[model samples]
Target: MKILYAKDFNRVLDFLTINLDGVTLAFSTAENDRSFNRHKDYGINNLNSIVKDFNINNIKYLNQIHSDEVLVYRNDFENITDKEGDALITSEKECAIGVFTADCVPIIIVDDKNKVIAAIHSGWKGTYNSIVTRTLEKMIDEFNIDIVNTKIFIGPHIRQCCYEVSEDLKEKFIDKTNIDRDILFKGRNLSLEECILKDVREFGIKEDNIYSLDLCTHCEEDIKLFSYRKSVGTYGRLFSFAFIK
Candidate 1:
């Protein structure tokens, strides 16, 4: 199964959406999908609007900290927007779990069996710590999932094409991950996509099960996809969510 454009995307807020195997995934475009951002200048919290548009109430979100922390979603989870974590996994149906990103990678994961789904925020730090793999391990522990049958989807983020980094940091990443140096680094620029693929593959996920939207947030400034590297102060974030319908 593939993640395709929703036929009704334009009918709603123009967010990119796709449904497959009884699951619905939605991602925001900076143009029309302005989600909850707390910056007073950008004050972009449209929760009521999102609920009205998507018709999902038990939407779980996180206050990401660029760490390897992952959570198992619960009905009584409190201070959700203030909770500290980088990933969420659940087997629950209809309730959407989401992550916010601005130049950081947003990953949506599903079991090949279609019994579980996950949302992750992987920044440079989170990627270095293998947040994706951690989430997958959590899925295995919580839902008895098989890593080989897992499908991972990568959303828009800074790619090697424009994700230039410091020499020390690049060297550190090169030393931390087992991915090929050439594939992970493009002359000091990092590929969050390749790094994630390497991590997932290490756990036996087949190449066919991995897909990336392949949009470069840093390079898509004109497209207005909320790139923190491309924006001045007071930038907003894009929301990416998924649920098993």
Candidate 2:
């Protein structure tokens, strides 16, 4: 229930200090924001301010290939990639991870017991490739994190009510995973949220452990959720971020 908006960023250090358990979760909105995310292949320098304020020195980022590849950030200092991938996970508290999004679903995973966290960017491409499932697997294999005990928060994105797609796109979603197809497309509704939640359930994550923001970025124009589809071509992105405190 703790949500931080873009305008409140000036108080980042103060916000993080108010510990609802030192796991400060914050994300940027499309409004009152400043970031150099003009290039699709880069992150914003403004985000560096957040990282510094949060006391994170080791930052991890990916190129976002849109495939099922989950990048693991292990080192404290090194050159990061600009390649295309979907997700990132790390147990290092020394840094924060970044995921830029216009309308893509950004996810945060926190295993409070083990002090592990994950940041994932899931679009239709990532969803079809089972990126959520892949993230769960990586956590188990690498950090010995118990999926049953982990908590996940699904951030705002385009909801099925407005996220219309072609039959070809729908077909790819169906072929890529085993899900209740009826909920996927109800005449014109393509339930990406439902599909992702379903995949999370399939990965043995408890229903209670999954939290859905349930807000449609496309529908909330004034709120600045940054709808790439709505912008057509000209717009900046809201960088979704998460870290261990």
Which regions of candidate 1 deviate over 4 angstroms? 1-12, 33-35, 38-44, 112-114, 221-223
TM-score, predicted candidate 1 vs. hidden true structure = 0.89
Model 1 agreement with the true structure over 62-102: per-residue lDDT tens digits: 77889999998866766566778999988877688888888
Tens-digit lDDT track of model 2 for 1-245? 23434343334532212122445555666556453373533444565566676777755678776778887777743655565577888877767776777778888887777877888888888877778889989988999997777887777788887888888887777766555678777756687777778778877788877776666778965455677887796666766666776
Cα misplacement distance, residue 218 of candidate 2 (Å): 0.7
RMSD of 1: 2.8
TM-score of each: 0.89, 0.85
Model 2 stretches with alpha carbons more than 4 Å out: 1-20, 36-43
Model 1: pairs clashing at backbone N, Cα or C within 3 Å: none
Kindly provide the TM-score of model 2 when superposed on the true structure, using C-alpha atoms: 0.85
lDDT of 2 at 31: 58
lDDT of candidates 1 onward, in order = 0.79, 0.71
The Cα error of candidate 1 at residue 87, in Å, is: 0.3
Query: Best candidate per lDDT, number?
Result: 1
Residue 72 lDDT, candidate 2, scale 0-100: 76
